[model samples]
Target: MNLENKYYINNSDLKITLEELKDKGIIYIENIQRGFSKYPNLIIEGSEEYVNNAVKQLVAANGIENSYADFYYGRLDEDEKNKVKEALNEREIVIVESLQLSKDDIFVHLNDELLEILLKLTSKEVLFSTFYFTKYPTLVWGNYGRRYPVFFKDEFVMETVKEQIWV
Candidate 1:
């Protein structure tokens, strides 16, 4: 199944959870960062057993700091990666969502890899537009304009700074 969904979490809360995970030896922050940077909108879908096991591992390593289970890269380490991967492998399906950006009438760049995946999911009838902007001598940027026609049900989208790019 395709897991494409969006969530908004306070940055401070995310940071606290990361810190707690690190303290309990559940995950290495660096690994988590790498994963998030590489795959922002990742939908980790697993059976009840898989989810329970993964959560157990996470809790045993470190108790939950926040009530949410949103994983952050800066809080995961090598061992955590392996555990998460193992849990993912045992699951029946995993769907990753590609994030589409929009800002005050402007669209940001979409990573090529994400674009290819989106193309496969969308039909030819879908049209995409992008807008470019220049701000004095400071900088110039562009955005993907709007959301694509495709939809993701359970995926997680990480919202970052407007000027940042996730690839």
Candidate 2:
């Protein structure tokens, strides 16, 4: 049985009750961050029977808007590349880390972390972007006018930055 159940929460103010759902047998949980708090979407994928039961329990406790019928399933495939060659080709290493105003301190910490990662990840000298979101300390990827922000969510750290890096 394909287990892909989609659900939406209208008022995202209520903290997500992950433990309760996990106890009911949730195999995986993916948060769809649309850069908006009002229409937050979460994908809970697992056994069809178990996910449905878990959703019922979640709705009972949180009263979150449930759209169980509309679920999206995605597969992630990693692209293997030679980092040294990419660097030799003058591809500016784009290190992105998602950030929030409340956790600006976290930004400072992760920025330092990204710098360390870049130092190890690339052979070329690292340069910081001064134009976009200077406070976050962006890195230029390729050449002139190709400056990439270190705290972006699109290219490199899309998966790790949201929950792991910054927080």
Candidate 3:
């Protein structure tokens, strides 16, 4: 989804939402996507050592220095994939630089493992497997119900692939 095209309703209170996500095992560096991308993907912030290791592995895989400094969904070679997988096995954290987020700009994808916890902030009456923040600033489930799909504009799902940076 083009975040620029769709209307975004900033949430009145994001503190509660941030706290809730913390309770769900989602680690993020708020307001850390401004220079990289318009949408903020859930980035992993870690210590210098870990971030450096992650960068080295990513550069080896993509053959692009500093590419791991931002959020991207690019094809990785098998060797590169293995290296990233190995790093994740150690449970390292990664982050993006110059990305900043306010509570109002935050949104989570429905498929996120932490979605169940996020839904607690929304209505109990609406049973939505898929979710997104709408113009109302209320959590809405279902893609057809909103202008953009959940995690459409600002989203990143870092599975086993660990692209990271120092905070």
Please provide TM-scores, in order, for all candidate models, with all chains considered together.
0.18, 0.17, 0.21
After TM-score superposition, the amount by which residue 82's alpha carbon in candidate 2 deviates from its true location, in angstroms, is 9.4
Clashing pairs in 3: 31-99, 31-100, 31-101, 32-99, 32-100, 33-99, 33-100, 44-94, 94-164, 95-165
lDDT value, candidate 2, whole model: 0.25
lDDT for model 3, on a 0 to 1 scale? 0.28
Index of the highest-TM-score prediction: 3
Tens digits of per-residue lDDT for model 2, 129-154: 11111111122221123222122323
Report lDDT per candidate: 0.25, 0.25, 0.28
Candidate 3 lDDT by residue in tens digits, 50-87: 43243334333333211111111123345643543343
Candidate 2 local Cα displacement, residue 2, angstroms:
30
Candidates by lDDT, descending order: 3, 2, 1
Q: Enumerate residue pairs that collide in model 2.
A: 92-141, 138-150
